[model samples]
Target: MHWNWQQEDWPHFAYNASALRSAEDAFLKGGGIIVGILHHVDVEARQALAIELISQEAVDSSAIEGELLDRASVQSSLARQLGLSADRRKANAAEAGAAELMADLYRSYQAPLSDKLLFDWHAMLMNGRRDLADVGRYRTHADPMQIVSGPLQAPRVHFEAPPSDRVAAEMERFIEWFNATASDAARPLPAITRAGVAHLWFETIHPFEDGNGRLGRAIAEKALAQSLKAPTLTALAETIHRHRKDYYAALHRASQDNRIDDWLAWFADIVTAAQARTTARVRFLIEKTRMLDRLRDQLNPRQEKALLRMFAEGVDGFAGGLSAQNYRTITDAAPATATRDLAGLVEMGALVRSGELRYARYHLALSN
Candidate 1:
């Protein structure tokens, strides 16, 4: 028999509340701390973080659907949407469309969710695609839809969506439950916990012909935004993409058997993990800014450029930190000039020069 969560005995979906209490608490605490930390930052920092997170979310969300998009192009599209100037890379139609949809989600996640709005989002996702004929509409035929693996010659279906006749009705019920669960304290599902269940529920329904995974994540993003009452996308998509195997397993693990404790814990953990990553990134930005401010008088134009480059690239910016040749190339400075700049930075404690001549590397003087 096929597995289903739409059965009547399900979604009261019994699970040990106590099992989720700690993980749920941890996720909530982490999000609160993230929001609190973000409150003190200036508008510029917040905008930058928002752009980065939203771009990451968009790119990774598409990636989860097997549609690889250029990060630069997506950033460019998003920058145009937010009126921020970035690297100035041009975006193709798909990148522009994805970025536009992502930006819309960030901007209007506060708006009410509806069937029409979702259909619009679906069209936007396939904006430039020549492959999809159904762009925005729900599946009209009864053709069986299954998540599968292996060659088309011998495919293996991991999960099958509800039949076409049932899709519309299933969606109606899902939408009704979504509207009610958030406000009804009598419901066993807490509003916050409902986001995870919502994700599973929506994905299982798989209403649209294409873009269901991406749109389903968008639904999750909406749930998350509602819970936080914030305008930001927490970038959980990148985390999910990284651990996609476990992500799929977590969904399948929640079956008609009705135990969803593991799925709930996993969802909370992923959200908390996403928030933690954004927290660390924002903190790093703040610290980098603080450090640069303290070194304003100590750094020359070339040294400052080199520092900015490192900061922009983060971990992979410089393998063992900047080299004299790197500084020379980055600043377009002569070799002697690059050496002098490096020497000056070392003297000012902005960098530490390691190794003997010809083999030396420049590392940031920041404490490990």
Candidate 2:
């Protein structure tokens, strides 16, 4: 079932071209909306910061174990990147850790790097964490690497040491080809196609002792970045994480049969979808910012901070709404001051009182 990967497998699919153009158009339009939203928040400077953090975080998460990094770490890293105090330091750390890994991955392909270079990247991705660290430079000699599972759990042996030096030679040849083919401008390839080739070729080489899947993805992103000549703003890793089962299946299908048209199509579709998803998220965040602005205009500084905190954290920040107790907790106000603030918010139509006095909860008066 092994299909030899060749250039001819790429079909003249006009539809793919149209789809990519449409996706790019939509992305640009969405960018405008993102800008509008940022300006609305009076934080337009934050947009670039946000996009960079998001891109780096995405790359890091993909190269490492998905969901292994916690939310607090992600937030703290983002906060630091944004030059804000990270209330969630743990989340920021996770995101910062991921960004560093992604940066290292991008830097690795300056020249034709070695398998040891990939090993070091994998080590850094898994360093100080639980899942994938110890197997960094080491090679699995006794145990064979199994890429596919279920009935198709085919075991493949990779080289660890000397004597059978053909593996290293083959790997070097592959790396040379990868570096040369990706950079050649005369026969320019689509970013999606390059990503597919990078993934398949890296997996085929199986250069590392472990973390091949992670490294393969990182290499794919590197190729994509090279093709696009811009930092990837889309969350392709998150999209892959969501479709992990299908992702593995697609890779398996590609590996077993070399009709890479389907693989390329799948990769392109994922990229398109990832762009659409991120665009939608940016739009939603923009809308949320508008709502926050409207609410802030009518509230005092302390009340505004309380409202923003609630919006950012949702129900976790305050119990249900700005009750006297909730206000006190959120603004560090005394009980009487908290009561006055709640009453002021209610009078200003920012907070609506629900139920009787004893059981009342103040909720934001959101408009449709």
Candidate 3:
């Protein structure tokens, strides 16, 4: 069977734009709220929010490619990149590379898309990898670039990209289309719709030997940011990673035909949901800042240290709730001191305690 790229009208994607009106409106509305919140917050709060969102995108984007990265390491790497005060923990090569790409993207979202920029992104993504015939450039191997599944002997071919000789020309067209469709362009698409189309188009090309999925998601974020004229803190990768199987299935179906109404609808829903998720995350960060401000100088040094450690775990807080033992481990306090600190935190509304004595678990009051 011929793929969508092999069709007569290849790349001339047709969709009912009017059907996505509500989704587009929601995206713009959510984007305004996020920008308003960021404007009102202090510099430190904004930096923390940037670190949280970029690190999550780095981690989740890598996860979508079957590579599991340490979220903490990614966060630390992003914090350092942002010139924020961070711990001494040095991120490994993979985590550092992903963070570098994300940090660059977040800082330079307003720049126009180009071949050099995409190559640079690919270079950052393929950092520390020894395998592959090509790095930081398009695939050059003569063999067909086909995505497959199952065992080596009986592989299921999911999709095959264009031949190697055609990649350079294909990508040039893509970059031009991308730049021409920007918000300031003569003919621009809606924010969410543009992002969705950009993602699918890039992924279909699959120019890189590796890191296509991650870079595709990055392009989608770029599309959204370009339309909004600001950096998007939306959790697009995290949302896609949540329903990874469904995401792949949707792509597979869309690859069969040029009519992508179903795909656009699915992508619009994902973008809307991602916006809602980011809205909640921004509110949680606000609450966390307030809690820290409220308890400033109220708790002892150990209590302060432990509370910050828990907050480092993001909106989920410490997993399974922070136990008294966990508190001692983080603060290196004596048993009695730990108990008093925990009690003080709960008393001051910084933590909510559950269970009794040995079984007691303390959770951040601001955890979502």
Candidate 4:
């Protein structure tokens, strides 16, 4: 497919008054609910969910590192990746690693700076593990790196990275446009629309040797957060993952013709969907919190502590389910005491027992 640069007509896309207004309205409405949920969610659950959402999204966006490693491997690798001293590798290691990295990024969203800084952020994302994570710190000798889409047998190089010299200049122009357009209250485009624009512009620039897609999405996230100016509760990454094909197709269409209307519309729809999904999740969390609150009222301090630790640390001190050993570690109880605590939790409907006595794992009833 042939792609052309929209040099002269670039600002026209940015200055689309009607689209901007529509996006703005949608952003504010969606953002309000997201912010509300962010504030009310239990910190541990929220953090875990956020990590899961971001990591899954990163993996879905073609993080080969995630693809190569299973969940347990990913977790152990990520601990190694981040230089943390954790030996507990579980079934979903890659996801755990991605989640940890994503959590770090989410934390950074609390104090957002410039979109241009995305280069450094992207670099940091892939710094430790070069195998799966394509840390593109230096320029490559290869020119016009080919990006293919569609079927493998007849895959199409839909987009090409610019020559090395032009890449930096083009990226700067895109960043300038992004910062200026984002801050312009007079124009006042919606956060969702801004997200679409950021995604498109970043992909259009295609600065690095690899991982541009993930970085572009990350940049979109920053734009989304800036638009809301609140802690992000919605898993926009999940929406993107659900509509992966459409997401790529929209970028393909935009790059092919340099017309962003369709892309913006699709992005707006995804934002709306993500917000709706997050709202449901948030409501479930609230209900779970209320249930836990009631359960805590009836239990002694030890039982309450056990429950809180389980929820906070997750299904047995892991992302998924917990083991009997986890109970011992979490509660500092003897085998018999841990068994009693687990039985109590099961009785209270907070944890569901799985497997036989010797190999039982505990799962949070509220997580689903």
What tens-digit string does per-residue lDDT give for candidate 1 at 81-135? 9788777788887788889888888888767677888888888888877776566
Number of the candidate with higher lDDT, 2 or 3: 3
Candidate 2 lDDT at 267 equals 78
Candidate 2 lDDT, tens digit per residue, 1-368?
A: 32233224322222335445554455445545444544544455355445444554454455445446554455455455445555544444335655555556544434344667766676665555555434555443544433433444654422212212234665666666566656555455556666677787666556555556767777776666565554445567767777777886687666544446677678777776766665555554554566666676677787887777765553223566556677788789887787788888788766678877768787766542
The predictions' CA RMSDs to the true structure, in order, are: 3.0, 7.0, 2.5, 7.3
What TM-score does structure 3 among the candidates reach? 0.90
Per-residue lDDT of model 3, residues 221-299, tens digit only: 9999888888878899999999899999999988888899999999999998888888888888888888888888797
User: Is candidate 3 or 4 superior in lDDT?
Assistant: 3
**Global lDDT scores for all candidate models:** 0.78, 0.58, 0.89, 0.64
Q: Each prediction's TM-score against the native? A: 0.87, 0.62, 0.90, 0.67
Q: Report the Cα lDDT for residue 312, model 4.
A: 56
Write down the worst ten-residue block by lDDT for model 1: 183-192
TM accuracy, model 1: 0.87
Worst 10 residues of 4 by lDDT: 63-72
Compose the digit string of candidate 4's lDDT tens values, residues 293-323. 7686666566676667765553224564778
